[model samples]
Target: MTDEHAPATPATPAVPATPAELVRRFADRLADLGLTEAQAATRAGMSIAYLRRVLDLGCDFDRPALLRLAAVLGLEYQELVSGRPEERLHAAAPDADSAPLVGPPLLGELTVPECWTRLGPGGLGRLARTGPDGPVVRPVGYLVHDRTILYRTNPDGALAPDANREAAFEVDRTDPKLHEGWSVLMTGALEYVTDLALLAELPQPPAHGRWVRLTPGTVTGRTIRTASAR
Candidate 1:
């Protein structure tokens, strides 16, 4: 007979709603493992600064570093990405009745037009530049205007590039469960947009102090998909 008075099993926590929440979960897991951030970073083969930035500032999500860190923390990659404990157990032991294993991922290059299509209407992307300390990469919201990239920032902010300075921008999306994604990169010169006439025609009014444009010298992209999906 089932004991109605028996203690109930705890419900599994819901998946993190955002990247910042995922980082917080990582912190909790780190504490559970009784390891400091420095120790975890060392075991994960990454710099403490980079780990701190990811954990503390919610900076760019570096996949390779995260995969290594997940392994170091004794968790599966999918579990780390999805915050689902069941995924870890499932990865550890597959059911014999389950479907056959998926093949390796296939990568293919994207043409210039295809790259633009992938970047349609723009959204959030990483802007890379050389700063006083070293290479700097930060996320910024952008829009594609007349085949050029436009983003706004404070005139004195770190994202503010000098006239015609060289920089790189990248945007990507992925599905951890499906293991498929695409990334588009733009290498170009960044300059201030001073054309009042052109600025007046923007779909949305400038929200920041200054508008900057990335005039691409080259555009490239790549897509990754599981062989089974092909």
Candidate 2:
């Protein structure tokens, strides 16, 4: 009798980027199509928990999962497999209106609800606060929960225990070609969320265990676009 072994699996078309980046791109694209994570997961034939696990670094996913994700998101499988930057996710209709602005571009206010919608649930944003050295700003990974901004930081980090201090958190999206984008600014006092029960209940990046909440005193935003752009 001859010894037999299974044939080697084919290698991935390209080196896979960090799962978080791939997942974020997927999520953002789906969001542009007005779909939520749960909806997308269901359509992709995967549990939300499994999707979240894939988004968390160190988790494993096979090519079948990748195929399902690409098909559900309407992405090209080859582009995804090769991690092509030119095929980066963008607004579903990148050039919906190509007409010139009737007047001039102007900054317009975005209502609180609009701001929250644009902020979504995940991504990086800037957190600005007053420090001993005056004002400081740092990039932070954040999630929106119950109209409040939440992020995790080391217990000893400067931003971790700022319980009564007012701070500003901002997130934005832009299109260089269109010269248009929107920004949301949230000003609030920081509050520590040390309750284990409460922490477990909130939606956040899986790798972050320590968290702080920003209870917004004011949620304001602005957008730069022509009236006809929409």
Candidate 3:
């Protein structure tokens, strides 16, 4: 007689051996995350057509594209490419004096000029302003122009600040492996950009939206160095 109370065995995922199989595996991962092809492509900063083409045609392995896709899928690059889970060893504590003692992290304040230097051709930053509900912080792509912070936002969006309202913007960079980083903060009056001439002078046109400028009243920065080379 067959047993009626046997536990169901979990199905094993198939190992991918070909380009087409790998793409299918990627699709499976997206499904697991409740994401669609378009969503995954968007998060990977690639076009939907490109994603679909890969899925259909099974192109050769592209490292850059695969890396971005792996990040979006929340999988390690090796794990995604090899169709196997990443193997990581638990780090063991080092014995006392096993290695040269790199003294405690050195913290230092940055000068005004140094702060500007650190902000160099900005990438992304946090914009803080008061919204209809309360204080709000949003991530925004920004650039340092004429010693002021320039960013784009929807005119009616929650991130858009009132005319000449006080706001704060911050940018930072860190390397987890190196245990070193720097952060710069700016407090200023935020206002909508009405100067078309100034906008034209920018290296590139801002995204289709209202351009905002933050004229900082005070700027401050700090840096932490854990390695001797810094």
Considering every candidate listed, which one attains the maximal TM-score?
A: 2
Residues 1-230, candidate 2: write the lDDT tens digits.
Answer: 00011112223234455676676677676654445688768878889998776656422456677777777655555544444322222233346346455567767787777777667555678999988888888888776667888787776666765655789999887655445677888888887776788675554533644678888999898878543433
Compared with the true structure, the alpha-carbon lDDT of candidate 3 equals: 0.66
Runs of candidate 2 exceeding 4 Å displacement = 1-24, 27-103, 201-209, 226-230
Q: So what's the TM-score on candidate 2?
A: 0.57
Q: Which scores higher on lDDT, 1 or 3?
A: 1
Write down the worst ten-residue block by lDDT for model 1.
1-10
**How many backbone clashes does every candidate have?**
0, 0, 0
**Model 2 lDDT on a 0 to 1 scale:** 0.65
Per-residue lDDT of model 3, residues 1-230, tens digit only: 01111112233343433576667678777654445677678878889987766555433545678778877766656556555321111012113113342678778787788888766545678998886689999988776678998887887787676764689999887644435578889899888777889765443434557778899999998877564322
Model 3, stretches more than 4 Å misplaced? 1-103, 203-208, 227-230
TM-score of each: 0.53, 0.57, 0.52
Residue-level lDDT tens digits of model 1 in 121-153: 546789998877888898877767789999877
- The residue pairs found clashing in candidate 1 are none
Please identify which of the two predictions, 2 or 3, would achieve the higher TM-score against the true structure. 2
